[model samples]
Target: MSTTPLVLLHAFPLDSRMWDGLTEPLARRARLITPDQRGLGTATLPDTGAAPSLDDAADDVLAQLDQLGIDRAVVGGCSMGGYLTMAVLRKAPERVSGLVFIDTKAGADTDEARANRLTTAERVMREGHQGWLAENMMSVLVGPTTHAERPEVLARVRELVDAQPPAGIAWALRAMADRPDSTATLRAADVPALVIMGAEDQLTPMAEATAMVDALPNATLATVQGAGHLSPLEDPESVAKTVLDWLP
Candidate 1:
């Protein structure tokens, strides 16, 4: 980590700890400012009745930078965090120096996918985080290999999911479902960008990753083999190396 700081956003359903493996290495030449998404970290939801939107989530991240006296940083996020990184580009373009998008897409959810997320939200409100995780988490979030080879990873995932506040999850779940498509924004964003895809990612497949890379005017794509949706956990070393190589 350098004396100069950079902001790093955490993926939804997980906290900044997900970046733990890479922090020391990433911080080697740059300071990292990681925030737990609304309801996940020290940040909180707004008192206004405004329902949480993806834009709102991005606003929260930028707001954190303002709070810390940080004007801009190379923004990076995983999955939902990546989605928000795109949002940040749209909402706070001046604050972005670069982007690191991992295991996420720039398109809005399909009808079926949106419906499924809403259903998951309903269940989360009714039964809370565990029920939400039990029903929809494993199949979508964890790669098959990790579930088999690393019990500790799964356990850590469970701990992270289980630790979230019900209310926080409720708002974030809703926020994710309502996020706008950012394909256009990415295509227009002329910043240095890294599109990191998991070779075995089931959620955001290689096709989606390709679409993002193709759209971005200045971007490079790297694949982490033997990893899945949550590549940070399956191959943190690969993810770290990519980030390190990109830093100016």
Candidate 2:
């Protein structure tokens, strides 16, 4: 197996802690680096203006790589993390050895979606992430199967969401809202790619994942059945197994 490092970025409203389950299992095969993006987790986000961009977050990942003396590695992400992965590819293509995109899309947000995200950011800042997120995002974050069968997963998701700082949550929402369409970027990325999607994902469904697979020069799709947008957190073993099988 290749000793290339594996940097797995976390989704919005959560930090590097989300990847806890996969640490022991994936560590056996590769050096896993999971860092909290700027303004999230323990990492402090500098007082950048309201117009935060994923490029900045991408740069943070590259800085982390530099700190570790890793020239290149397979980078993977889920949800908002996928946007950061694409931003990394956009900014520093040579630094990426492979790509793993889980439960995300390659398209930019539509005007309506963008507006909604901005509104959510405002609401999160104003109302805080406590009641608003639990009420609004819980159902949308996970699939019906998890909602019906996995109460523990629901609790964990809630715990992660509640732990996020309001500013960080708001910043991520705005950043994601303004991210560019990554289809062309993916078309140009010549590295091996794995696109994992939840079979029951409400946000980015199978069609979106298929679209990413079609655009990439060399990419494969893995379906995580019975999961939602947060496939890794929903079923760590299945996602890890798919990743292990796909690793170069």
Candidate 3:
């Protein structure tokens, strides 16, 4: 093993391309792998009949690492990808050296949130991924601050998201709706970890990340001002720098 310790698995509503900004700097020394979750990017979608759950999503990420022949590596993720990283840490603790949780949390959706997620998932199913891609996804991803100030970043986020499969988006949203609460699991993981969030995040919000930080014994929390849910995209340079600083 070369001992390069990290692989970046990005969140939903986007693909591995979301990690582009952070890759060059991270690639210098860390063995980094940025993979699109199942059905999101170039990766083949799951059999429609057999959708993925949080556990299955975690398995998919581990499977990606296995295919790359990385025996042990740090795992980092954002948004839904961040939630899945928690699943990976739970299901394959031995394989994870550390974790980078960006704009994500360890809790499951509340009942109302779950209902809203289902509504979104159903919309993706009915309206088609491409349609949803153009409409809803564009608005909520980057906070209004980023939307007005940094059009380039917002454009990049849309460009990357447009490449995804509709079924993948629907499946992921449904899976997230039913994900198990992993606060207990996260609290138990005694590894070095980074829990980061955007100070002005509207979706996951900074308070959620704070609760997550409170539970993880070895985790450090970092906040980016004026950014939204997608910290890696909204402020990639700063996000990447924080990640590098956190790593051994």
Candidate 4:
């Protein structure tokens, strides 16, 4: 196995801690660096008084690599993290050796979705993170199997969501709302790619995963049984095994 570093970006309204389960197993295979994107987790971005774009978030990750003295590495993400990964690929394709897109899509937000995101961002700013998580995020974060069989997983997800800063969450919502379609990027990518989605993922279902796999120049899809949007947490062992087997 190659010892190339791997950078895993977390989902929206969550932080680097989301990847905790895969850390040890993945670390044994390759160096792993998980960064809390701006305003999320421990990363504190100075208040710019404007909604940051996905390009800005992508630059932040590249800057992180520069700070760590890493020239290039495989870049991957889940959900919102996947958006950032595509942005990074657009901005600095030379720095990415491989691509791992988990439970994410290649299209831009629909107009209605963009409007919804703006509304959610405003609500978060006014009502705060906890309320937003309860009213808007909780239902879509997991799948039926997880809710029925894994209360602990749901609880952990809640804890992670609750811990995020409201400002960061709002910023992320706006960033996602404005992100561009990445289908062309995926089509052009020549590096090895792996796409993972939960069998029960509602947000980005198996069909969407299949579409992404078909777009990539070289890619494979792995479905995690009994998992949801947050597959890495809902079924960490399976996700880890798939990643370990797929990593270049």
Give Cα distance to truth, residue 71, candidate 1, Å.
2.0
Clashing pairs in 1: 1-27, 1-28, 2-30
- Against the true structure, candidate 1 reaches a TM-score of 0.94
Per-candidate total of colliding backbone pairs: 3, 0, 1, 0
lDDT of 3: 0.82
- Ordered by lDDT, highest first, the candidates read 2, 4, 3, 1
Q: Model 1, 1-248: lDDT tens per residue?
A: 34546566777688888888888777887878888887775566666788778788787888888888888788888998887888889998889887888899999988887888788778778887774484367676768778778788777777777887777877877888888889899988888888898887888889998999999998999999878888887788888888788775
lDDT string for model 2 (114-219, tens) is: 9999999998888788866865878778999999998998888888888888889888999999899999999999999999999989988788999999999999
- TM-scores vs. true structure, each candidate: 0.94, 0.97, 0.93, 0.97
Which residue pairs overlap in candidate 2's backbone?
A: none
**Reference-based lDDT, residue 25, model 2:** 79
Query: Best by TM-score, which number?
Result: 2
> What does candidate 3 score in Cα RMSD to the true structure?
1.9
Preferred candidate (lDDT higher): 1 or 2: 2
lDDT of 4 by residue, 144-197 (tens): 899899999888888888898898888899999999999999998899999999
1-248 per-residue lDDT for model 3 (tens digits): 23476878787788888888888888876888888887788877767576558788788878878898888888889998888888898898999888889988888899998998888788777877664564676676777789889999877877777777778888888889878888998888888889888887778867788888888889899988878888788888999899888886
